[model samples]
Target: MSQNVTFDDRDQSVLNYSPGWFLTGTYNATSVGQTGTLASSSITNVNVTFVFPTPATEFFYFGIKRCCGGSYLICIDCDPNDRKFITIDAVDPTDDGQSPPVVLFSQKFSVAGVHEVILMNQPDPAFGGNSQITLDRFELTVPDPNAVQPTSATSANLFSTPTPSSTAGPELVGSASSSSSNLAPILGGVLGGLVILLIIVGIWLLVRRRSRRTLYSEEQATAPGPQFQSQWRPNSTFTTLTTPGTTISTTTSRRELDAGRIYSTYTESADDPLPPEYGQVFNTAGPSESSSLEPPPPPLPLKASR
Candidate 1:
């Protein structure tokens, strides 16, 4: 499916020459887009532009009539800058009136795209002011539209031939940008995972603290405390409710009086005053409650007999 598209110098659409060009050659075989700018003011070169179709071409070849020709520059998708162009010069011998058309300049490109090949007519530096050239025609290796394309795997393994391009830094810059894009999501995932772990730890600590406080409260409520016991009997013989040597609160002593008696082993004389500890108890007691504490009424004497 490889094909060649040839453009004769007569084709005005392909080659754009500056002010010094004159049409002076046969049809389609050889022509002139050359300029004698050694002593001229016009500073532009001849440019051949090609618009490659869908399946682009990979190489170009230019046939020129070379006797005293200078150099042709190859620039792909770039403006004419003499500082950055591929130089292609044909051999120039000393005495030459005319010569056959030879491939003076040819180049192959790695990437297929729009290309601009410029031909600047500077006389050979060796023969300053004595160099000249004749433009014949150019050919482009284009692919057929119905050509069978390579499979994906085959394309991946295919390496485009190295080209004389000076625009190499942009590719490396693009690679660095893609690497940065890939790292962004990984960093975000790490940060998100750390935040989730912190929340879980906080919740666990809160639950542990509340559980400790609840257990402490339950223990305090069920602990042992003070105790009290009592038995009430109205109109009975006075009896001591508190154990010997044990102290009784005033509230308990008054409750005993309400049941009709308050007993104490503090009697020293029949008319002696009560002890200070018992003074409040007797002073507040009713006469019936006080008399219940006295010895039981003597048995009534029998009527005059034994």
Candidate 2:
């Protein structure tokens, strides 16, 4: 026998068909008939409980319709196991046609008996009149023992739990802060090294320039003094003279001299006075020559008037 519960019949008492099933909530049992179908009223904080029959298959399905745009939270409580929650956001379409129903919950059972499902309506005030949900149907299918299990069952969980969160927002912010913090030291080190190098280069250049200047100054101080040339001039006139046995001609030139020596030029003459060193030669001269020599002049009386 197929095990299913469908809320489409518009009869609220049909829900009592399964003795193991229970439902409670503050909501209307049915809505006004529209076209060929009827829908259940929107409900909030609803609870549904049921027991799975033994020897049943692994899949169960729950169908619901979103009447408006809003968010909802569904929580399932399976005893002796962890509770699980799923959040759903819905949007109303612009088309006037009826929106299709979707599977609100599905699970594969490991150990199943009694299970409670809680639905929390999170209506958005911004959605105005469109925030609601309606129940359509539910099914518990028992597939053939030899049949292949569908891949879609992996998403469905019977006693599934949410893992710990690994959000990236905080980690990204920390990394950015760390990088910025390290940047200052790196820049400082580079700038400091550059400044020291510039100082060293400046000192080197200054010392080199100073040494060059000093060498140039020393060369100037040790250099030789200026040299002077001597000027010469010839006499404007020459004198001619005669001697008994020889004729002579003489001319003189003038030149400036240093303090160490004095020079004078004169011609030889026979009438020139003889020095005492030549007295013997005069004494040896002939008597007639001696008589011809003139006598020396007498000195004046010192006191003739006295």
Candidate 3:
């Protein structure tokens, strides 16, 4: 049967149906049906209802269960165009042989005032069955705008305050400066060690040159005099004194003392001539002048030549 019930903002109602055929469309099932199938084998009826209000978004649900039936019954849903009306698989109850059935449908329609909605037998063509569905109770409620949902807890309602900078403190800046200052001593120590090494090497070279000069002086003092003259080895590679006609063998140990003063004494050889200063001493082979056998001369009076 087809039925209709109009609803507004404040009012609510329920529709009643019976076992015999009638013409009713959509209405509310807020209350129990009066004259439909009760919990017994004598009647099997089906009830459907619809509701309309001001256009709004809403949710809908329904309940179906057996009041009483001898057979194991079901409430299966089927496509509207199928021939055989199918019921869902039923569970047999041991206590009262009653099984509860539930079918729920929902849709949102945008229309202003009273609008017509349809509720059908679903897969019904021949339209009458002893096994029935009964209307219990339903809800058509509107949600409030101000009501909080679960998402509100984690949402960012507004911008959060910015966190302070990590390096804002002066103590952190001071610590960095102090770290660089601590490295200064280590850098200075390394540079100081390199300078000291250079100075030590320079001092060692000066000491070594002085020691060589002292050794050369000692060697010159211990050398033989010109009476027992032996040729001295040349210390350096170059020669200084040269005679006009004679090829003179070079002497090494003689050094210039001052102007017109030489630390050298000459020895005459038969092969080479001597200078004029050593003329009497050069070839006096017997009883040379101022021999050791000659007497000492008388002492003269001392006078200052002024």
Candidate 4:
């Protein structure tokens, strides 16, 4: 069961309850208690606050009614900081003379952060009794009129008009493919240039190696530089270079000698003896020198004796 709000015995602190919109009421109840009631001839007002924590762009729905058999006006007290309000008139009834219980109103009101919506009564000048007004339910919601929908703009009622489409044709697919193919030639040219650079570097290395070999052959031919000739010659002598302060030591090789023989025989007979005529020529005196001088002395002696 839904609860009912009644102003049974609420003493009039001021002329009216300054704030708070009436959510649910039976305003014609004539009860009096600590909880005050709204009457048909009594005048009261409803206050509302429109709040948005973020920058919200939505429409709002509010419902209102009157139990009395007269017209009533819902006046909105705009934000004094910013003048903005909505006025709804509950002036007519249904064919059965029943006033509309719930009416939804929405607008494209862009609110920044937070804003308050105040609902106040437009005190009518004709009636003087404590007349009454009632509120059922109020809500601020994004407009979604249909529960199940494929597209919001499209309606199940075919009588309603339709919105137009926003897309183009399939030629865009071919154009995108052609644009990608045009880039392939540029990529191939870059790869071909890199291959040519590698070929050039490889040929340069081959030429350098050939030139190095040619220089090495030229050095080799200019001087046969000592062919390693190993013709064995016995009893050859060569000077052995020694350090300035040291003698070059020749290692004596040992040879096993026959027990009865000696090495002196080999050294003495190894060379022929000098010729005896070389010594006789230097020792002989000449015979002609003494004979000539002695013959002249003998002739003089013979003359002197005769």
For all candidates, the clash counts are 0, 0, 14, 19
Ranking by TM-score: 1, 4, 2, 3
Candidate 1 lDDT at 248 equals 39
TM-score of each: 0.38, 0.30, 0.24, 0.38
Q: What is the model-wide C-alpha lDDT for candidate 2? A: 0.49
lDDT of 4: 0.42
| Candidate 2 residue spans exceeding 4 A from truth | 1-39, 50-64, 78-84, 95-97, 111-114, 125-130, 143-306
Candidate number with the higher lDDT (2 or 4): 2
lDDT of 4 by residue, 104-205 (tens): 354445532233444445544444433344443333333233454555434555446434435634555565577689989989999999999999999999
What pairs collide in candidate 1?
none
Q: What would you estimate as the lDDT of candidate 3?
A: 0.41
Best by lDDT: 1
Better of 2 and 3 by TM-score: 2
Better of 3 and 4 by TM-score: 4
Better of 1 and 2 by lDDT: 1
TM-score preference between candidates 2 and 4, better one: 4
